[model samples]
Target: MRVRRKPNPNRNHPLHCPYCASELLFPDEETEFAWSCQDCLRVFSVQFHGQDDPPVKPEPARSSHEALANSLKRKGHEL
Candidate 1:
């Protein structure tokens, strides 16, 4: 018996190339997780190391002491 599978819609979520955002990315059938960009001509592979999350940006430190001093100076109470 021949079984026909349904086509996936969300499979092409990230269809653009990283190097060139305007380029279309094509997956290599011979290699798993391998992708190529038509415009940039870049051949790369995708892999998930379980948790390959994006880097987090550090928050700027609050200057409470300087702010307090500035407020005091504005009220003519220089310290």
Candidate 2:
């Protein structure tokens, strides 16, 4: 009997840019938990608090422009 191994979620790569909604290509500039988007030229990171942790509530954005600005600001980029 052969035992099948479950796929690892950590091996998955992001398919799109969370900031610009652009499709990401192979060999994207990557770090341990962050990825850089070439289209928006922004760096984004995702943190998993684990299944035991409660979901986080994101801050409300007044508009798309404000959201972009806030995202960039969080990434230490000046717009």
Candidate 3:
């Protein structure tokens, strides 16, 4: 008997051609990991190396006045 596996809903699929950067239409999967790009006519494979390090926390947004002051400082101007 053939065992059926449920499809993952959260899985992300490649949407653009890696070589030409053109939008892919119905990309063909040659194998479990290999994909074919129609525009560039290139076959490539995607693999998961490992989980990446956690993203660095972004700096808090600066107010308009603070932003202007920084811009002036860069231009060698004093507020």
Candidate 4:
């Protein structure tokens, strides 16, 4: 079975400009998955993989090992 999507004019699809962090990148052709960032004046393409996986969750800034290494470095314990 296949699923169809209904278009909603008021629906907000979130996408930000990687360079300028602006949300004004409009599509030159949505079917072609091409987008243009007005703030950066750059054009880019969005690719969707076949897998229906969820968006990746953000990781922490430092893992336990990294935190331990930084702690040792501060105490003059060179590895």
Query: Which structure among the candidates has the greatest TM-score?
Result: 3
Clash counts per candidate, in order, are: 0, 0, 0, 0
* Candidate rank order under lDDT: 4, 3, 2, 1
Tens-digit lDDT track for model 4 on 1-79?
Answer: 8765555344334479767888998875444566788888887766655666569867758988999999999999986
* lDDT on C-alpha atoms for all candidate structures: 0.68, 0.68, 0.70, 0.71
Q: Write candidate 1's Cα lDDT for 34-61 as tens digits.
A: 6788787877766554655469866766
Please identify which of the two predictions, 1 or 3, would achieve the higher lDDT against the true structure.
3
**Model 4: how far residue 69 lies from native, Å:** 51
| lDDT per residue (tens digit) for residues 1-79 in model 2 | 9886564455446788877788763333365566677788887766565565448867665798988999999999999
TM-score each candidate. Answer: 0.41, 0.40, 0.43, 0.42
Q: Across residues 1-79, which tens digit of lDDT does each residue of candidate 3 receive? A: 9776555443346777678887663434465566677777887766565787669967889999999999999999999
Candidate 3 clash pair list: none
RMSD of 3: 7.5
Q: Pick the candidate with the highest lDDT.
A: 4
In terms of lDDT, model 1 sits at 0.68
Spell out the clash pairs found in candidate 4. none
lDDT (Cα) of model 2 = 0.68
